[model samples]
Target: MIHTNTAMKTQYHPISILFHWLVVVLLIAAFVVIELKGQFPKGSEARELTKTIHGFIGQIIFVIMVLRLFARILFGAPEPKNPSQALAMLSKVMHWLLYAILLIAPIFGILYFQYAGKEIHFFGFTWPQLVTPDPVMKKSVENIHELLGNSLYFLIGIHALAALWHHYFLKDDVLTRILPKMKGVRN
Candidate 1:
C-alpha cells in the first residue's frame, strides 16, 4: 500500500510521456518536410510528394493533440511549484498559447488546401470537401498556417530555455518532471 502523500507526489503518467515524445517525433517530421519543400523544383513530383506527406503529418499531429489533451486532463499532470506568482501566470499562458497554436495551425492548413482546390488526402484516404475553392481565402489561410507552423520553433525554443533555466539555475523539477525515469538511479 502507498501513503497518500507519497502517491500524491508529482510524476507524469507514462502514457502521457509516451504520447509527448511521439508528438515530438511527428513535429520533427512536419518540420523536415516543410523545410525541404522549397528545395524541390516547383510542380515537381518530389515537391508534390513532400507536400502530401506534410499534410498527412499535420493532420496526424492535430488528431494526436486531441488525444494528448484528453489524456492530459484524464491523467492529470504534476502540479507546478512556481517561484513567483507572475512566473506561474506566465507559465500557464505560455502553455495554453502553445496548445492553441497546435490546434489552430493544422485547421488553417486544411482549410487552405481545400480552398486552393487541392485534394486533402492521406495515402489513399480522402477528406471530404469543406468549402468551394477560393483563391483569396486559400492564400490568406495558407499564410497564417505557414506562419504558425514556423513559429513552433521559436515557441519550443522558449519552452526548452525555461526548462534549462529551472534545471541549472533554479534547480527545480520543472525539466525532470517530463524526463524519463531511470532504473537504479535518482530520478
Candidate 2:
C-alpha cells in the first residue's frame, strides 16, 4: 500500500488548491462564452469572437491541466479523514472521471477545429491544424466534443454536491482539503 502522512496534512498543497479553483473558473468562462455566442446571429462577428474566446479558454484549461497533473504528482493529495472504503473508492473514481473529461474534452475541441479547416487562435498564438479538413470528420468530432462538454455539467454538479454533503452532513475535511486556507483563520 502507498503510505501517506494523512494525520499531518489537513489540506492539499497551496498550488493544488489554486489550480483546482482556477480550472473551475476557466470552465465557467468557457461555458459562458459559448452560450453567449448564441445571442449573436450565426456567422456574425460577435458570435465568431465568442467562439474564439471559448477556444482560448479551452486551450488555457488544457495547459493548466498539464501543470496541475505534474503538481499533483509532485505534491500528493491529503487522504480523507476516516472515510469508509466504499466512499473512498467512489471518490477516487469520481476524481479520475473528472480529470479524464477535463483533458479529453479539450483535445476533441482542438480536433473539431482542425477537422473543420480552422486553426485555433489562442490568445496571441495560433495552434497549427493537426488534421486535414474533412466535413464528415468535423461533424463526428463536433458531436463527441459537445457530448463531453455536456457531461461536465452532470459531473461537476455531483462533485459539488458531494463536497457539500461531506462538509455539512458527514462533517469531514473532504471539502476543506481542496479549499484554500484563509489567513488568520482555520479551515
Candidate 3:
C-alpha cells in the first residue's frame, strides 16, 4: 500500500489511524479508571493506584497527541467526503476544538498535580515540575481542568454523531475513511 504520492491514499494514512485508535482506547481507559476511584476510600491503596494509572494514561495521551499533531502536519488528511462547503467548515471547526481540548486537558492535569504538591509520575518516569505550589492557583486550574475534561463527553458525542450521520444517513465515506481496515464507500 506504499505509494509515492500522499494524495493517492484511499483513506487516512495508516499511522494516523493507529494513533487515533490508540488515543481513543487510552482516553476511555482514563475515564473509566477515574470513575472507579470513588469506589475506593480516599486514602486507600486502591484509590491511589487508580489515580496513578489515570494520570499515567493522561500523560501517554498527551505524548500520543503530540505525535498525532506532527503526523497530521507532515502527512495531511484524506480529502473530505462531504461536498457542502458549510458542512466542511463546521467539520474543520469541530476537529480543531477536539485537538485543542485533547492537548490542553493533559497539560492541565500535570499542572494541577504539580500545584497540588503531588508528584507527577508516569510509568517509571517522573515528570519535571513546571510550577511551584499555590493553593489558590491549584484550585482554579483544577476547576478549569475538570471543566475541560468533562466537556470531552459532549464534544466526543457530537463527533460520533456526525460520523454516524455521515455513515448511516448521508451514506458517505466520512466514518470509513478513518477506520483502520474499513473500505471507503464509493459515491
CA lDDT scores, all candidates in order: 0.83, 0.86, 0.85
Residue 80, model 3: Cα distance from true site in angstroms: 3.0
Which regions of candidate 2 are displaced past 4 Å? 1-8, 81-83
Ranking by TM-score: 2, 1, 3
Of the two candidates 2 and 3, the one with more favorable lDDT, higher being better, is 2
What TM-score does prediction 2 earn?
0.91
For residue 73, model 1's alpha carbon misses the true position, in angstroms, by 1.3
Residue range 17-133, candidate 1, lDDT tens digits: 777788789999999998899999999999988888888998998988898787777777665557898887787778778888998999998998899888888767888998999
Better by TM-score, candidate 2 or 1: 2
Q: Which candidate would rank higher by TM-score, 2 or 3?
A: 2
Identify the candidate with maximal TM-score: 2
* lDDT by residue for model 2 (107-179), tens: 9989988998887887668887778999999999989989999999999999899899999998988898898
Q: For every model shown, what is its TM-score relative to the native structure?
A: 0.90, 0.91, 0.88
Instruction: Specify the poorest-scoring 10-residue window by lDDT in model 1.
Output: 1-10
lDDT of 1: 0.83
lDDT of 3 at 133: 91
Best by lDDT: 2
Q: In model 2, what lDDT does residue 27 have?
A: 99
CA shift of 156, model 3, Å: 0.5
